[model samples]
Target: MTRSWRPWIAGATGLALVAGAGVIWSVRGSDPGSGCERTTITIAASLDHAPVLQTIADGWLRTDPRVDGRCPDIRIVAARSADVAANLGDARAAGGSAAPSISPTAPLSPSESAAAAASAVSDASRRPTVWAPDSRAWAGLAGTRPEAASLLAPGAPSVALTPIVMATTPDRAGALEGRITWPDVLRQIATGRAPLVLGTTDPTASTAALLTLMSLADTDGDGKPTAAEIAGPLALERTARVYAGSVDVLAAQMSPGDSAGSAPGARVSLFPATEQEVLRLSASGDAPPLVPLYPAEGVAPADHPYYVLNAGWVSARQRAVATAFLDVVLGTAGRTAYAAAGFRDRDGTLAGLTSASGALDAAYRGRPLPGTAALTEVLVRWRALRRPANVIAAVDTSGSMTEKVPGLPISKLAAFRQAGIQAVRLFNDRSRLGLWEFSSDLSGSRDYRVVVPVRTMADQVGPVSQRETIIAATNRLRPHSATGLYDTIDAAYRAVQGIWRADQQNILVVMTDGRNEDEDGFGLDELLGRLRAAKNPAKPVTVLAIAYGSGADVQALQRVTEVTGGRTFVSRDPADIGAVLLSAMVNR
Candidate 1:
């Protein structure tokens, strides 16, 4: 059992400065010698504790803190915990080292050199010396990286604890004052009995959001879930309804407190947040004081593990500095800072909590996070079970695609076919996907024609897997005419808008290789006007465009997608277009 220390109250200044700013940027300690002689360590941590960490580092620096025999400088950068894990995962996948630099002496094209340099710089920025993500849940997701075993030192201690809770107004919470479990909440959401619209942070970008989904996955209280449990139909249906975009969106809709009276536009009912976040919300007083309900079944508290990266970039002196930093975090002053930030002690006990919040006992220590493989299975199941989608894949089969790609044996059209075939596999069986080919004189008068009608992958009218049909159709795609870009985009967007399903994400995927060449079709300006006129935020439809090869009109395509809150991917080389297309599909 962990011991509870004296309740130490922090000054109001700590609350105002620490929680208010999402990120804390600072350099601590006196300047070290120039170049290699100087040792500077960078630590990227969760946004919530950046301020608390900054305070600790600043104080230590003023006292000339040192590790081993050398005094060092420390810098802290605040970022989302999921983002940190992803960065490390990326570096780990790339041979557990920073991206290799382009050889200056080797002969290379300007574009090739630029691409290599850009990739290297991006990888370097993400590889920090130390990482303190919000919870160990990331361990399962990130442990697959090549350096995962070494990234987190053995016997690492958690600096603080904050249980994930459902935040709602005090009055709403009072009606059901007893214990609540994740299953109960899921039931409420599924049946429309939920008092407020249940929402959370983006699972792909937030650790809390990911944990919320995992908890929901194993409603039977079976510790970690098996593959069958994760892949079951009931779990998929339940999880699909729980996701409500990112937590920030829900936070925006919140009004300060109960007294404000629900405003005209404000409408979030309940949000999944850390206990610290719940306390922070209550302290703001701008919204109604929220009641934090610790689910009775179990909880997954963010333990905030301090990880030291085991990379070659980290020097001996830098490792020593990292050790010193961890000491300060687990020490007396660090405990006090954590209390001020509305966190529980390592044992899940409330120590020196100055801020007011709903009553919570110290007994709510959550279950141990699932093993690496179990967590991976949960994530994989989510991808297959997420909300179904409706996509109209518009491919430009203009004559330019007939030209052979320089480095490969296939033509541009063949590469796009392969890309389309692969990308379709990423979607769930419930998703409806259709294919269309566009070029001047696609028909007697029309510039585009639907080759495959949009239908769910499970539809019995076609092959057993609708995805395979789409891939097979790609084989028949042939380049023969001039590009009819503008008219095709307008037609597809309007067509989808008329039948947009509220339950599914409606999207228009445009793969083109050349500028508009239609002599009689609608112009770019006319198409943009139609899109703007038909725009409805409530029934949003995104247009994802892929400009394949050097001849594509990327700038023009960007304008069309930007108006719909979508993005355009440019692939100057057709050989690599498959990867870019796949990325666009997954991110969307």
Candidate 2:
């Protein structure tokens, strides 16, 4: 949209207001009255490069006001690449819903028709005119749909490049330097013999995490993988080992001291992150400087792409302005600023700050990203193939849960039972699962009663397998007595810890409603103390608590999860318990 604008001079000094130390020189000579109007272009870009892009945009505005009647007023918004991709996908899905059905009996006037067309343009323009995502995978994802495809301009050029890497202390990097490949990292973790503690960001959230999975899946020399390769048992096992919850969790565990190397006490010894992230962390001095180790195989670099949208909201003039904005980003000054912020040039070559930026070696090259279909396949495969969980499910049989769910005829307990069965199906034969129904007086003096003991699903009974037994027992669960939330949580945590295996993602999945009602059991203070005392760094067991219905004590649940490394999932509507349980079951 074009807007009447005043002359706004953003000097190079504005660049310093952002992250990283970059010397940005502004382009001058344009007066405020030089251009009649300006087209405001909003670019939703990855968090890493948004500030630098703004700097470039500022320079472009000063250097050249209007290329063809429309001056550009670029506004850069920070967003995750995956989020932007998801938004585009959602917009495409909703494209047709906004159209009003016109009856033939009443034709609109010309003015009304113009208003309707403008309204349509406004709806389309609600989305960003330009999207500069971290990797080309997102662009590949957006191209699959007609609505999203219409928004994309051809030939999106890479503005900057940063390879995903495994960063650790110098000692760990030295140890694994020449010997390490993508599979080896997973193998080391599976064997519980990794030279350093391995971790990665959440695949669902971070493109780097998914790429890390892709690298492991790329068994052959070629970056592309066949369905057969991804479905193989070994590949799945490796991917499971590589995922260590989320990046925030990993970052929290990192040692803040410079002297802290790959010691036993150090939370994370090795993590997969962008090179720029590693530099940022090191620069902050809150953590020790990490030494990046490139894998023996190829790497997937986040080649930030500038895509000028071809949507109805973006006029021909706006398109030209976006192209001009891209040119400025690819120009010499833009390259220098990116180099200062620890990014490689568009050609995948190292920037001027070789030593300061910990530049990648010349041999390191960018690998081709998987196609849209294959990438989608790999992500779906990852969910199923992830580390088999050792879960002790505490299904609350509290009296409150007996009440019927809103709008649905089924009771809360009934919904949970069905959901339990559905969630159990997500785990495979490799997983160890168990069921426990908790409420006061259910198991004679205890607040919790173990219905099905935790055991490997592969174990054989007299006739049926252990997995079938758990499913059958879960379906038979019934609501009974008062909620013994705190005591049951303590018992489950202790029980899961007893059988904790370093390789497995040991967890206590507590599905409950209402606060601790066991006056006879230990109070919240005592339970919290006990849980804190039960903490074990080497063998971690996260508590995934699901607070079901309005009566569910969310505050109490959060307190319980704080002691453990797990999180609480709330489903206020009992109708959504099934979906919520399914999501909570996934490791991500």
Which candidate leads the pack in TM-score? Answer: 1
Work out the TM-score per prediction: 0.57, 0.57
lDDT of 1: 0.68
What would the TM-score be for candidate 1 when compared with the true structure?
Answer: 0.57
Tell me the alpha-carbon RMSD of every candidate: 14.5, 15.9
Q: Which segments of candidate 2 are over 4 A away from where they belong?
A: 1-35, 89-95, 98-126, 223-249, 256-266, 357-359, 386-588
- RMSD score of candidate 1 (Å): 14.5
Residue 446 lDDT in candidate 1: 81
Q: How many Å off is the CA of 261 in candidate 1?
A: 14
Error of 2 at 526 (Å): 54
Pairs in clash, predicted candidate 1: 196-269, 201-247, 255-287, 256-286, 256-287, 256-288, 257-287, 257-288, 258-288
Error of 1 at 284 (Å): 2.6
Off by over 4 Å in 1: 1-24, 31-38, 89-93, 96-118, 122-127, 147-150, 175-178, 227-248, 256-266, 387-430, 433-588
